[model samples]
Target: MEAKTAVNVGQLSRKPELKPKRKIKWKNVLTYAAFVGPALLFFVVIQIIPFLMGIYYSFTSWNGISAAVDWVGLENYKKIFTNDAKFFNSFWFTTRFMFAAVVISNLLGFGLALLLNGALKTRNILRTVFFMPNVIGGLLLGFIWQFIFVKGFASVGKYTDIGIFKLAWLGDEATAFWGIVIVFAWQTAGYMMVIYIAALQGVDQSLVEAARIDGASNWNVLTKIMMPLILPAFTICFFLTISMAFKIFDINISLTNGGPFNSTESVAINIYREAFQYNNFGLGTAKAVLFFVIVAVFTTVQVVMTKKKEVEA
Candidate 1:
């Protein structure tokens, strides 16, 4: 009987050990929640709440200052779609700018990355100089460019009639659009170059050697081997370019203020004019909602397509 009792006691002790182990798992779960809960709470409170509020207000005729809110139910959207000439024009202009910026910025950044990736003196200093413009505030960049376009160019024009200095850049619609493109490319190229540089560094040295052994030229190795391997970088860069192009405002305002008779007014500038400047808060909010959908859709499509390409590559 005593032997049986000893065996039962041993079983009881083992059972308690297992129970503690189970309780420890719950403790780990609680600990993770404790660490993550604050950030999730902040995200919901600040970002999600405001986003939901913006969507709600878009369907209403709220002047943003008035207490009385009336539901207009897509009237603002209808106006933008059907009757707003300025909105349509701004949309086309911004789309064109987006395409131009993406292509020019990526090409220039990639070229710079290639050049700097080689063995050379002063490459690091050159990188810093190129990236300095990106660190400057967008509004500040705009103002600086405005001075260049309006005053600095004029002075240069008086001194020497050469190198695009004498052209009416901001005063003319065509020139203003290209001027914005050039400024944006200059500011962003350095950033893209850094991304490309990182990707280029990650490429396998052995693969390049193998391609060379097969009598492949430098161009063939770059296009056939290196490009495919760096697809993930391309995905990230493309998405950033698209989103930034869509949301660009401070630079647009500082550079041209959507001027030259609003010919260069981007969608972002147009939305601001509708809301704060014109006091059409509802319409502005509606435009904001539309803008959100457009950006979201574009980003989603690009990600899906590029992610597929990445997987295939």
Candidate 2:
């Protein structure tokens, strides 16, 4: 009887030890919730809720001013697909803009990063100057550049008789498109350069030393060692630029206003007009949903491709 009683007590004592682990687990969960709960709550309330509402709104004919919303099934999507030439035109323009903006901005940013990453007396000053444009609001930046293209360029061309500057930047389709690209690249490159600078600074100097000690050539060290390591920066920069370029709005509005025959109309402007200007909220929401899907897919693919490379590295 005594032996049996001791075994039961031994098992009961082991069970108490398990209770501490359960308490520890619960404590960790509560700690995490305490720290992250507010942000998560805000995100759900602000972002997720609105997004869900937007999705619901896409299926109804809810004019901006109307309290009555009529269920329209997929009619809005149908119209967008079968009859909306303007939307597609906007999509095409945005696509081309995205490509040009992403390429030029990234190249300029990466170049500036490389330049300032080296030992230079004025690098800090240059960094601040470069990043200053990005600090300016997009609307303000657009208006400033519009004046530059319209008045400043004209004056410079008048004196210099430069054919390039003499061209009507905002007054024509081709020039208008490139004008936005130039301004966007100029504004964003500096910001991107900062990101790259951080990533470049983060590279392990010890690894570079090891490579050099192993008789690795400078080019090899840069190509094989540095490039692979800083791949994450490229991922981040490309992702940001792609998203920014695709969903462009303020610059388009202040600079071109989709003028010279609506050549520069972005999907964002198109959706805005559909909702507020034209009062076709349903159609606008549908377009927005589609735009969201396209952007999500594009960014997802980019992240996946870049993440694969990161893994390989």
Candidate 3:
């Protein structure tokens, strides 16, 4: 009887341990879900639902505030491509901006990253200063720069010989386009530089040391070893710049208001004007859908092409 009682007590203790372990496992699973569920829910509500609704609205003539939504199929799309000159013009404008912004921003950013990666007493301070522009609101930056372009430049031009201040930076066709590119690159390059700095730090010190011991020149080492290693950063920067340049609106509106005869008007601005200014929500939504498709296709192709290069490198 005593031996049987001892055996039963041991079994009871073992059963309690097993129960707590199982309960802990379930608690951990629930905890993970609790942490992750909010972000997923927000994404579904804000992004996924609106995206689907935009697609649906693109196919209908709702004017954005009507109880009577007429299904128009592809008429809006057909009109955008065939009848609207502004749509094609804005497309070209966006394409040009993307090309200029991507190339200039990436080059400047890489250069800054290389410079800042070296050990110096003031390097950290400089990096903070450089990245500060990116944190400022785009509309505020545009308005500030617009004032500089209009009033401050004129005063500065009279005093200094830089010649940059003498030109109509945001008032002329050619100058306005280049001006926007310059501002965008200036703001975004530091952000990209930070990314590049992260990537540069990840490069293996052993590889660099081996190259130095092999009597490789600095240029040769950087070009052959570092550039190839940082191809992933290049891919990310290019895609970001491309999308940002294409979607630009606040800066364009605040600085030039698509002035100089709408020469600097972007696709986003065009769509906004179509929807709100002209009250053609169906037409505007159609343009937006096309814009989304074009951006998706281009970004997908670019990522595939660049990723292949990264793999090859």
- Model 2: weakest 10-residue lDDT segment is 15-24
Worst 10 residues of 3 by lDDT: 15-24
TM-score of each: 0.89, 0.89, 0.90
* Candidate with the larger lDDT of 2 and 3: 2
Q: List the residue pairs that clash in candidate 1.
A: none
Per lDDT, the best of the predicted structures is: 2
For all candidates in order, the CA lDDT equals 0.91, 0.94, 0.90
**Model 3 CA deviation exceeding 4 Å by range:** 1-26
TM-score of 2: 0.89
> 1-313, model 2: which lDDT tens digit per residue?
9999999998988844444333457888999999999999999999999999999999999996878999999999999999999999999999999999999999999889989999999999999999998989889999999999999999999999999999999999999999999999999999999999999999999999999999999889988999899999999999999999999999999899888799999999999999999999989999999999999999999999999999999
Candidate 3 clash pair list: none
lDDT at 34 for candidate 3?
Answer: 99
Sort by lDDT, best first: 2, 1, 3
Tens-digit lDDT string for candidate 3 (136-199)? 9899999988888889988999899679889988879999998888888988999999999999
